[model samples]
Target: MKTLLYIVLVLISFSVTAQKPVVNSAKLEEIKSYLKHFEDNDALLGSVSVFENDKELLNQSFGAIPASRTTKYQVGSISKMFTAVLIGQLVEEHKMDLNEPLATYFPKMPGASSIKLSNLLNHTSGLQNFVVKQDSLKYWLKKPVSQQAILDEIARQGVAFQPGDSISYSNSGYYLLTRILEQKYKKPYETILEERITRPFGLENTFSLNGKTEYEDTAISYEKKDNKWVKLEEFYFPNVQGVGDIISTLSDLNSFMSALFNNEILKEETLKRMLPKDDDWFGLGIMKAPFYNHIAYGHGGDTYGTHTVTSYHPESKLGITYVINGEGYPTNNFAIGLLSIIYDKDYSLPELTEYTPDKLYYDAYTGTYSSPELPIAITVYQKEGALMAQGEGQSPFTLTPKSKHTFAYLKAGIHITFDPDAETFLFKQGGQQFELKKK
Candidate 1:
């Protein structure tokens, strides 16, 4: 009995020492399959980087060649994180005040008195996202707007809300940051990034790609179609400046976030200030969104033929930088899903159950369903003995049944709640509700 106990103790010790947290290779393969599926379905052409404890478990470039790791992707609004870090570094140097009004710097805007630098960083400034309002690419290309021009746009447009009132993302706000940084430092935004963030971190492959020269090993952007791919001409928007204008690779982005959370860049106190507050996710310049027990600080970018997200959690010290050549490719959702899978969280995806609704019922719902939020009413129809709904300005997808009265739209991650009110039915997708009478 003594001998058996000793042997068991030795075995237990060996097991404990040998055990290490590992990414399930099979799960990684499954993730790879999902990426291929996205490429097949969404026509995605991009790269993904997932790491745990600074170790890369999955690194795969999916789809066609133009936009791979070797190729630089215009990482859209993700540049905001860099701008945030620059601001953080400046704050550390005691060169800039976070709570000061913008008027202190440019002092030219219409209602500069109402706008604060912190508000601009956090998107609470209520300033319009000028990119949304104007023909961003055309105007920017015609005569690349300067930092002063961006400030003038904000000043001309005036405040969207009182300082510190609410959170609304504004590219103009970050553009203003670029202006303020330039005004204070006497250098362009690109120079500031090179000096402050990229150089200090030793990111050789990372830098702003503003159409000055075609970068070597940079991925080409593409649009996917019926089992094929279409090349997209990339455009530049210098007006967005530091807001949406940035180019980098998945690997370099991963390095940036790792160094950022590891305290290689800003001090811990400055990082704390740079992070978001309780019940609020926007911080000095980064976005703080909750994921499991930890919070993720990062940003996503969207531009023509490209979508990207880079995020990291301080507690786990894990970061992810994902890029796609397709706009609105659900990069954030995929990032969160990837994390959930890694942690073995209970994740539920809407399943496409074999649903067969009454032909008459399908006919009743088949008319063009209109909503103010949607440019076109969703058209429901019976095809191949299955009911499907085609959303306006969206890809056509089938409606799978969650119940006799409710149906979930695949790919769109939305459910159509049918409220039968006599001859009429009300459809609810998210906060938007629409009423459609049987026609």
Candidate 2:
């Protein structure tokens, strides 16, 4: 009787152990379902993988590909993490000071005399955005520009703001880091990336060098422009080298995120600087957000045709990577949603409520919203018994108020988060964040 009981107990234990949340056939199907839904919504095209601690829990590809396991996808701004790691290496070697002025490195970026290295990494150097101000779609479609051209353009425009005053996303900042690294190592950015970062870390699927892309098994990038799917055309190799360009697999991204969170790639002190808190959304090069009781740090990348996001939790060592070949997909929100499920929590994504504001109080929100940088003033008023918004040239947009002050644009897919202290609201749309004050 005792022998029989022991056998049954062992079988039950094995079953329970086998059911832990790792990549299994069932989970693979679930991931596939997600990809199918993503394609159905015209959300994006891409691949994905999930990891718990160091073990790869899930790897799957969707949309126009076979053998995608070895495929190289344009990781877009996911390259920023590589830049950050390289910068960390320089700091570790005592070759560059993060706090020193940017002029120390390039010495040619017009106001580099005053811009600090830390500001460059933190996006607070008041630098004008290169791609946004230019004919980006046409330019990216043609070919990549030389690194010298990037620097020259910045020098021509000069600095847009005083250092360390505000946060603005700038690809130019990372481009400048590429120049600095080349100057310091006496080697190309690709060489440094391989020797110091990818190769050393055993990230076999990631590559910094650009050549003919092997797309046999790669996910095809697509964009839903004007309500139709548009295939993304690849551009000539970019010269920004270390900054915003790289090709990687989901496996490599998961490995990189693990190394970063585990402190295998950076000292504890350096990693602390990389965590969110320096700003609401961005750290040195990673994006930080509150996840359950622990802090999540990672980065999201979106170039012309591709969008990617990878995140890892420090306490749980849980991580996820969502790589989409198409631009403008909601990878960040999807990543957040997956995190919520893994942790068995819920996320407060923007939603529309049935409750409409009372006619008496509707006047309170009717006014012009003024911001310094935005090109137009937002006019908020009640229409057809519902509050709506419209700018100078934009069509009328509806508002879904989550609370008394918090509102979301249901049609445009943005959030209006009000700040009590500033007596204003912040509008976030497609990773572009800005503020508005009542006029």
Candidate 3:
């Protein structure tokens, strides 16, 4: 999940070349072959698109989801890019100022006087990630909610720290920004989006969830339960309008990125402010996703079932995007594998393997685990006919078995090797490894 929720998949930072960009038939073939390996293993389902100079190098849909060329998929927080551009436009038109205090738009918000629009833009605002509360089921997350209600929720959660003191991924910041967009234009973010972003960009397939149940060409999302893919109920779109809701196809996303980098949307000067500055990985609405020597400026999004990432090397005019609603293969690793092949880095196609935990094993792993090396305690429990874990302040996520006692929450890149006899498990994430004892 990360820049994809508090649990959303964070787009890894990438770097680019000072040299020329190259795309050959062989590289494209390598990319396709690598994707096919995942497809053949029933490990992935969705579309992948690559474009250089606005020319398609690859536009292919895989998996059994029946995705056609124009099929729509939720792009998640990638919607932030669009929201940011709208804010950027208002700035360009002298209607809004990034340095203005949050008090200008939301005077009563906690730290409103101290928090500037720039704070909200780059996530330096102290606002808590309202989406994180959804993991705790404090609100009816999937129920439609009014704008006032969302603001109330954000206010209720309040600031986690003083403005500009720190940075954390908070959907609350975007939700507030989304409201500011609507308030400034006196229109819904959806309407402003069409008039300013989508329609102008000719991104016909890009749209909000719009309270509709069906889009003829939109692909459905699924979660792997046991070994079967089960349809996942989408979050109420209106409720997540600013944070994690926006739908589009791969081609459309790539096109949007191209336009943004090409200054077809925000002015080059404005776009510059939206990119990662100095040593930070986040910009206003954009971010830095890592490869090796090259950097990709873009965003990644994840909803309940669908997973996606959109990025381009602004210098090379090369963009890469993918949407996966179904996954037996880990989406991020798949992304890295694809990028590796594209950039001629060290890479390996995952050995797509499925694992089924013994039902009896479930009881063995269910416990509260604590570590002296960490502050949070992990509470493992049984849910959805599968093993799941919840940190003290995090959402519960399903744990897929890799072996009898080894499990992974692949979306978050978390691994746990449990030794039930010793009542301890070695936990790993982001390269940090620790042994947690059963408490």
Name the candidate that leads on TM-score. 3
lDDT scores in order: 0.65, 0.67, 0.81
Q: Is candidate 2 or candidate 3 better by lDDT?
A: 3
Which candidate number maximizes lDDT? 3
TM-score for each prediction? 0.74, 0.69, 0.83
- What tens digits encode model 3's per-residue C-alpha lDDT throughout 133-199? 6555754557877777778888998888998899888888998898888888899777888899889
92-148 in candidate 1: lDDT tens per residue?
788888878878976776557778788888878877655543443333433455555
Off by over 4 Å in 3: 1-18, 134-139, 212-214, 353-439
For candidate 1, the per-residue lDDT at 29 reads 85
- Between candidates 1 and 2, name the one with more favorable lDDT: 2
In candidate 2, what are the lDDT values of residues 19-89, reduced to their tens digit? 22344566556556656665554445667788886888777766543436778777767777789878987
- Give candidate 3's root-mean-square deviation (CA, Å): 4.4
Tell how far residue 362 is off in model 2, in angstroms: 35
Candidate 3 yields a Cα-based lDDT of 0.81
lDDT ranking from best candidate downward: 3, 2, 1
